[model samples]
Target: MSIRISAVAAEYGRGLRRSLDQVIGQIDEAKRTGVDLLVLPEACLGGYLADLSDADSTLVHDDPGPPELSVAGPELAELAAAAGELVVCLGFCEIADGRRFNSAVCFSGEGVHGVYRKVHQPLAEDSYYSAGSGFAAFDTPVGRLGMLICYDKAFPEAARALALDGAQVIVCMSAWPTSRTGAAANLADDRWTKRFNLFDAARALENQVVLASANQAGRFGTLRFVANAKVVGPGGDVLASTGVDAGAATVDVDVPSELAQARRFMCHLADRRPDTYYPPHSMLSVS
Candidate 1:
């Protein structure tokens, strides 16, 4: 009942093809190391930028076409093929029916398995991206794998939804931006000034499940996404983490027993009172 997880912090703001190659390399490396799962930075395919003014204008879509039925779409095949024996989770901009959404697509030897559109689009994101309506979890060989994007991790309900849905592994793809003054750049200690944030710990503590986060590295124009990729176990302990620059980390997780034990102790899922809980604002009132 072990889950071998890996997180790849790729160089931020690189071309789609080059970044895909790096991600493939990470997948291959994970395969060689017996890692069962691999996660990469957010927007790994489309590049982590609000707009692709810098990239060839032809690729940038003012009006994105229809959303591909699956990750097997022309743009995502190579990545899906490179997933090999491990499950790969990576992010990309979704072009669906003349609308665009920030999406993360999961690929495995079986092909596209899960897709999650980012729910909590941040302030700047509101201008360029549309918010996703809900959250979901999917079944996998390792366990129930949940999908979440960058800003979605900030919301407690996002993880709760997954946990309630019986997800054992919470996978997050983010491209968090840093300050411009470079104050975050010279942070020396983990106390007051830290490179990595606290979302991973919070999410793990709340859900009591393995939390894996992959973030981009380097500055995307004015945005600075200092790579901080890591994997947190069911007990909210960080198994492996990465620092600045493009790098990768891996960890083996004993998911089944850990999840069972955590649930047995806390028992959040068992104690849920779904029948009694009701929202005041409802389209259809339940009597």
Candidate 2:
């Protein structure tokens, strides 16, 4: 069966209400296009904060992080209602047990399906929120789904773990920005943008899974986002993309068939050499 999926590369401002309005509008647009699944950028609800300039300075209090929200809060409930039959995946600042997490949630009319906390904290992001312990895949209306938040996509093991857990489609939501230290004049020319695109293709090809990436666009605080949201087929082909602008990359594909075909020749998952290789910690211990 074919499913219509859309990955949104759009600006999410600081206000939560405004963000919800934007999400509602996107859902309406996706509905018109018969989109079965919609994926929005990381920190799409509360908006991401400025880059961490000081890794060790506790006195740096000028920029507070995004607002902490509960998974069962009214905001997510509203989004779930707006989603209706359409499956929606978006990132948020999750608050639970008085702790905040850089988290992503997937929901539909039936309510929340899955939630993922970002495991890999780049820069000083760990100062703001707690890191997730592991990666997991959950069942959704479209297919077996896995979610990654921002820097989590940088680590190969994260996607590999999810794929091993039976994820057919991996949705990576990012609040990625251009080079912070020496940014290029044009956003498209930025090196980080290239890495973002390369990672998407590599993860999909390696895992033989459909990969959908949604990223923040426009400027927020000191960061200038690179909105290169796209969907990649199992063979690492760019199915649809929003380039470097604020828009949605939509595509229709038969998920199972595409995965089967990609793995038909060489199943990377089936071909294992885990015992022959050294442990990740042991390898890190070497250098």
Candidate 3:
């Protein structure tokens, strides 16, 4: 069966209120296009408020009873309301155990589905958030959906695990920096120059799963992110691409077809020889 998804690549560093408003607007557009799911850029709710130059004073606490409903609190409700009959994946700064984490939360017809904390936090992110333990894929009406916050997509293992866990579609949310310099702009676009190829093309080819990515745009305190939002097919085809920064685009995808072709050609998982592949410590030396 074919399904449609709307990917929203927006600039969200202005503030919480403004960012959420934009997200709600995007959701409305997605509904108009009959999208099954809506994916937003990382930190869409909180915005990329924390920078490396400033020391982190933000607090993080684990979900005690119900989720904290202060500033970062109301976004969930708004997201749920906007979702209505659709599934959504929204990113934000998470506070837990006195530490901050770059997290992506998924909301669907049944409310919040799952949350994925970024594992590989970059230099700018490291100062503000702690790393996540592992990866997870959620089962939804639109098939099994895998979650990964920006930076996490850099690692192949993360995507591998999600594929192994039965995820047919992988969605990533990121706030990647774009070129604002004179020399860089003349040569190439910073987004592609910094390596959008490896992330979009390689991931789809390796895992044999459709990859959808949402990125932020515009300048947020010296940092710029021009939207390079894309949807890649299993065979490394660029199914749908958006050149501009802000706007909505919809793509009708066949999840089953991609998965079937990937399995037939690669079959990497089936050919694995796990019994003999042990850790170095477990392999005793015969001296």
lDDT of each: 0.73, 0.91, 0.73
Q: Enumerate clash totals for all models, in the order shown.
A: 5, 0, 7
- What is the TM-score of candidate 1? 0.83
Model 3 score (lDDT): 0.73
Better candidate number, 2 or 3, judged by TM-score: 2
Clashing pairs in 1: 3-253, 65-97, 66-96, 66-97, 67-96
Best candidate (score: lDDT): 2
Model 2 TM-score relative to the real fold: 0.94
lDDT of 3 by residue, 1-287 (tens): 89897776777754567767887888887888899978888877646743434444233321111122222366687778778888888787777777667788888647777888889976645765679899879888788989887777788889889988988889988787754344255213564434754587788877888888888776555456657777888877878767555655469987998679778956766776667765534657799
TM-score of each: 0.83, 0.94, 0.85
After aligning candidate 3 to the native by TM-score, how far in Å is the CA of 179 from where it should be? 6.4
Judge candidate 2 at residue 112 and give its lDDT. 91
Model 3: runs farther than 4 Å from truth?
53-72, 179-183, 186-188, 191-194, 274-287
RMSD of each: 5.7, 3.3, 5.2
lDDT of 1 by residue, 120-220 (tens): 87655655566778888998666788988887887888999998888889999888666435354343332211434577878887778889989887665
Total backbone clashes of candidate 2, pairs 3 or more residues apart or in separate chains: 0
Q: After superposition, how far is residue 275 of candidate 1 from its true place, in Å?
A: 7.0
